[model samples]
Each structure stands twice: as structure tokens, then as C-alpha cells.
Target: MTSYNASLRARLMPIGLLLIAMSCIQGGASLATSLFPAVGPATATSLRLIMAALILWAIFRPWRWRVARRDWRDLLLYGIAMGSMNFLLYQAINHIPLGIAVALEFTGPLGVALWSSKSRFDLLWIAIAIAGLAVLLGLDHGNSDHTINLTGVLCALGAGGCWAAYILFGQRAGEVNGMQSAVWGITIAAVVIAPIGLVNAAPAITESHVLLIALCVALLSTALPYTLEMVALPRLPTQTFGTLMSLEPAFGALSGLLFLGQALSLLQWLAIMAVVTASIGTTVTGRSAEPIEAPYPD
Candidate 1:
């Protein structure tokens, strides 16, 4: 009985780690919003990528690692997707609530989950995801309000699209060296994003407080959570990991409410849940789903 209990505990611990990782990521995103006004989303994104790269370099010492010439292509695409995903999502949360943005972004993964499905069962999940998106876009029942920011919605969807690309390419890149691929991806993301962001927000980028907040965002959203996820990855099945990650939108919503005071309506909450359900449904049944290793919505 004791041994059985120990086994149960071991199984559950990874889930706990994943939960904490998601929560930390959402909390980090909420915190990042506070900096959006001061430095703009572009600069904030640059800081996140740059700082995360530095942190990963320190820990992984990617300089010592050599990449296969064949793997470079996948790694390049993964980095582009990762950087673009972060930039677009930050643009998204700039105009809309974090929960809504996260829900919208989840469609990328949902679509990935359904990519090769010949299964009729997947249709129901697709319907759920579409319905959620429709409702959030205020397209259902032909009712959209001034409250909705179309640009934010579009950016979030784009971010989701990038996220799908990230997962597909990330799996390929991760095959060779595991999380060391992450260090490389992050370094590339920083290189790609820093110039664009710095060009846009030159004046505000140098403030001490901005640097501090960016550091915090880097730690909460990237460094700490990435470490936790790496630890949890081996312990859980891909299906279980995928299902648990579906909870991210809910955590994002709660973080917005708690830290950013972005209260969502009942209808919005339900829409987010619908997206989460679709994500969970598809990934639980999808043929090639896996845990996401990229940094989140920040």
C-alpha cells in the first residue's frame, strides 16, 4: 500500500509542476501588461526574448553545443515562430483581456491537434473550438459590440497560428538535444526580435524599471517555468500533458482578474472554456500531440 501510494504521488507530482508552470506563465503575462504602456508591446517582447536567451545561455551553455547541419532548418523556423508568437500575443493583450487573448491563441494548437484526423469524433471538437471563437469574436447570432477590438482578436489568432508552427517545428528540433534546442531557439528569437523592437521603442527601452520588469517577465514566464516543464516532461504521457495545458487559458483569465483586474463577463468565460474543451478533446485524441516547449503568451 505504501509503495502504491508513493507511485501515485510520483505520477501526480508532474501534474502539479505543470499547473505551477502554467500559473507562473499567466502571472508573468499579466505582469508584462503593466510594462506595455511604458515600453510598448514590441519592446516588451524584445526584452522577454533577449533576457530569456541570456538566461538560457547561462544555464545550458549552448556555446559548447553543436547543431547538426540538417537540424538548422527546423531550428530556424522554430525560432521565427517562437518570436512571432510572443510579439503578436503581446500585441493582442495590449488591446484585449489576457484570458480572451489566450483563448484565441489556443486555436493554433487546436488546429494542430486536428490536422491528420480522419476521425469523425474530431468534428465535435472542431465545432466547439469554432463556436468558442465565433462567440468571442461576437460573430455568433450576428452580435458584435464596440467593446471588442478586432485588431487584438486578429493578433491573437495570428499568435495561435505561429504557435502551431512552433509545435510542429519544435518537435523536430527537440529530437537531437532536447531542451538545448530551446536555448538555440531562444537565442535566434532574440536576434530576430531585438532589432525590430529596439527600433520602435528606442527612447523608453533604457529605463531601469523597464529592465527590472523585463527581467521579472523573463524569469516568471520563461526561466522558471521552462525548468519546471523540462522536469515534468519525462514523467507524464503526451496525452496527459496536452490535456493539462488546455487549462492555460483559464489560468490566464484568473491572472488577469487577479493582477490586471480584467474582469470578464459570463459569456466570455464560457467561450474560453469552450476553446479549452476543444483543445483538450483534440489533443487527447489527436495522433501526434505533445507538450509545448516554447515560452508562452508573454
Candidate 2:
């Protein structure tokens, strides 16, 4: 009985970690958005990245691991991608609902997952994702703004593209220094984005609540979630991890609804489901789970 229970616990622990990681990330996004009205996305992204970078550096003590000059390019690229994702996704959530922004941003990794696959079934998943995106893009119709906010949608897509870049560059960077590379990458992102963010958010930097929320965003979105993912990665099978990670958009939607009161139409729900389904299908059926199982910066 003891052995059986231990086995069951081992099987279940990674699942819980992934779930918690997703919740933290989405919850953090919702929290971050609350600051948008006061300081805007630039400031919020800057604060999150800066704080997260510091936390990661302290935890990893990256100075212990030195990188070759040859590998610095990959780390730099990865960091730039990370910064782009933070800035663009925050900008996206500023203009669009959290769920929609996340759903759209997911296309980046989805594309990466589908890339290099020759399976015929992958085409179906691609089509489903596209259909979901089509409906998602139409969601802002009849709102006070009139028509969809193309800027938000575009920003989400751009964020997704950066995610794809992060995956590719991360693979290369990891070969050199593993998680230390992530620390450097995040630090690089902070350096690149801090100037713009500080300028934009300078007016509200003195506010206590703003600082508190930014700290929470850093802990919840970047530090906590990334730590959870790193812990869960080795324990879970690649496929299981990928499938669970695919539910992140749904988590984002739920976070938006629960935290931000951003209720969606039934059609929007269905559209998000389609994207979720497509991601699941692709992961479950893919030849390799490498792309999906990669540690996400979301």
C-alpha cells in the first residue's frame, strides 16, 4: 500500500506543479493588467522583468556558471525574445481581454510544435487553430471601440512569434549553461526594457500599491511559475507535460473571468476551446514533444 501510494504521488505531482504554474502565470497577468490604467504596459512589463531577473539571478547564482563567448549570441537572442514577449503581451492585454491575448499569443509555440512535423493529422490541428483565431479576431465587433482592436491582436501575434524565437534560442543556450542561460537572458531583457518602462511609469513609481503589485507580478508570473516548470519538467513525461501546458490559454481565460471580470461570449469560449483542442491534439499526436515541453516564459 505504501509503495502504491508513493507511485501514485509521483505520477500526480508534476501535474499539480504544471497546474499551479499556469494559474500563477495567468493570475499574475490579471494582476499586472490592473496596473495598466495607472502606468501602462511598458511600465508593468519593465517592472515584472526587472524584478524577475533579479529573483532568478539570486536563486541561480549564475556567476558560478560561465559561458563561452561563442554561446553568448544564443543567450542574447533568447533574452531579446523574452523581452519582446513581455512587452508585446502586456501591450496586447492592455487592448484585449487576458484570455484572448493569451489564446492569440499561443499560436507562436503552436507553430513551433507543428513545425518540422510531416503528419497529415497536424494539418487538421492547424486548421482548427486557424478557425479559432478567426473567431477570436472577430470578438471585438459591436463593442464601444467598434470592430476588433487590430493592434492588440497584432501585438499578441508578435508576442507569439517571440515565443517561437525563445524556444529555438533557448535550445541552443541551454546546451551551454542550462538554467543559468535563462538567468542571463532575463537579465538582458531587463536591461533592454528598463529604460523605456521607467520613462513611461515614472509618474507612478512612488505609489506603494503599484510597487506591491509589480512585486506580486514578478513573483507570480516569472519567478514562481518558472521555478515550478523547472521542477516539473524532469518528473513528467514529455507528452504529459506538453498536454498539460497546452491548457494555459484556458487558464488565462479563467483568470481573466475570475480576477478581472472579463466575461466572454459563448462563442468566444468555444473559440478558445478550439485552440486548446488543437494544441492538445498536436501535442498528443506529435512525433516529438520537444517544442511543447520546453520551459515557457509565459
Which candidate comes out best when scored by lDDT? 2
lDDT of 2 by residue, 1-298 (tens): 9999999999999899989999999999999998888888998999899989988888989999768999999999999998999999999999899999999999988898889555679989998999988889884355543345889999999999999998889888888866788889899999988898897466787699998999999999988988888888989887888788789899999999999999988878989999999989988888853443456687
lDDT of 1 by residue, 1-298 (tens): 9999999999999999999999999999998998888988889999999999999889989778789899999999989988999999999999999999999998887787788555567989988888888888887655545257989999999999999999889889888787888888888889998998888685767989889999999999999898898889889887788888889889989999999999987888999999999888876666653445443434
Q: Which segments of model 1 are wrong by more than 4 Å? A: 141-146, 289-298
In candidate 2 the C-alpha lDDT for residue 182 amounts to: 80
- Candidate 2, residue 260: Cα displacement in angstroms equals 0.2
**lDDT score, candidate 2, position 104:** 96
lDDT of all predictions, in order shown? 0.86, 0.88
TM-score, candidate number 2: 0.95
TM-score of each: 0.94, 0.95
